[model samples]
Target: MPMKLYGVSDGPPTLGVRMTLKALNIPYEYVNVNFNKGEHLTEAYAKLNPQREIPVLDDNGFYLQESNAIIQYLCDKYAPNSSLYPNDATARAIVNQRLFFNMGFYYSSIGAYALAPIFFDYQRTPMGLKKVENALKVFQIYLERLNSKYAAGDKLTVADFVLITSTMCLEAIGLDISGYPLVLEWYEMFKKEQPELWEIAKAGMIELAEYNKNPPDLSEMNHPFHPTRSVK
Candidate 1:
């Protein structure tokens, strides 16, 4: 059976999973879920991902959700030679920690500061862009520490994929990558070395910007990451 990725076109997590698969040269079937039409809210997609999420990966009969977990599972199973997942226990633990942090701090901040404001009903008084600026300042600090090439250094890992997709959201929200030197370095490296993977994210960036610019009527958007989600 071909590996199938059920995801919305250009969605963040979906983009991350697709990039990982491409980097590993893994052949998979792309199942595009129409976010504009509430396709992901359907019962079938919910069954594939109890979270009612995108980037649900089905390898043979085994299924996996959550972008990072899907990336790890595929790297360990199909791309053992790929540096996307570290082998050492301690180093692997570090990657897990940062990955968790990305989900918590990185993604949440961007959603609140960037996506929520423009897409969602996240209205504020004189603090619209401020929300994103503050969160990006925190990311700048993290990037200062994490600015090194690759996730764990020299070799690209799943950590890079996670950050790349998340940062794409930041840029979509007008967060300037150049403001943070280290993050910009990593960004340039990906642009140069993994041009193909970068292109995937680049496509995502453009669509999201346009969508957010003229957001559709998402009356059925119930997912946590929907553009009109509550940001507190």
Candidate 2:
């Protein structure tokens, strides 16, 4: 059986993994979960991932959760020699740092500030918005320090895929990312170089924006969007 990727198409984490799979030319069956319909909360899905998150990778019955780990596993197993994830320890560490930053700081802020209100009807607060801006500023700092075309370094890596998706979602939600020149430059470069994958991400962003316009009814939702801690 081919590798199975479980997640929605436009989701940032799922999209990041999809972009990695495409870049490595790995063939996988995409199993899209309809969270709005509560498919992800079912017992069947729980067996695959107890946390009930999307973008779970099933490689021949070996299940893996978390997009960061999935992408790393793909590059390590399939494309060891590929610069998408270098074999050098120091270089790989830098990439790993960026991946963690994207997950913990960048994407988290965006979800709290913008996505929460849209998905779970959480009231947006001043601190939530500040977190988003601070996250962008920190990203800009990373871009400057790297002094390269990509987030990790001069070459594109798995980290770039993750960061790019977060950046796209950030921009999609009406944030003016133009203030960060380095970020804008890097994001524009992806549009120019990776048009197909860029469109894949853009389609998801468009869908998310539509949700913002017409908020969904989560009254009957079995598994609502509630993160561990409220944005502070």
TM-score of each: 0.85, 0.93
List, in order, the clash count of every candidate structure.
2, 0
Q: What is the lDDT of residue 49 in candidate 1?
A: 87
Instruction: List runs of model 2 lying over 4 Å from the truth.
Output: 217-220, 224-232
Candidate 1 residue-wise lDDT, 35-111, digit = tens: 75668778888888888777799888788999889988888899776557778887687677767767787766665
Check candidate 2 and list the clashing pairs: none
Clashing pairs in 1: 120-227, 120-228
What do the candidate models score in CA lDDT, each in turn? Answer: 0.74, 0.85
State model 2's lDDT: 0.85
Candidate 1: which stretches are off by over 4 Å? Answer: 124-135, 219-232
Model 1 lDDT, residue 55, Cα = 77
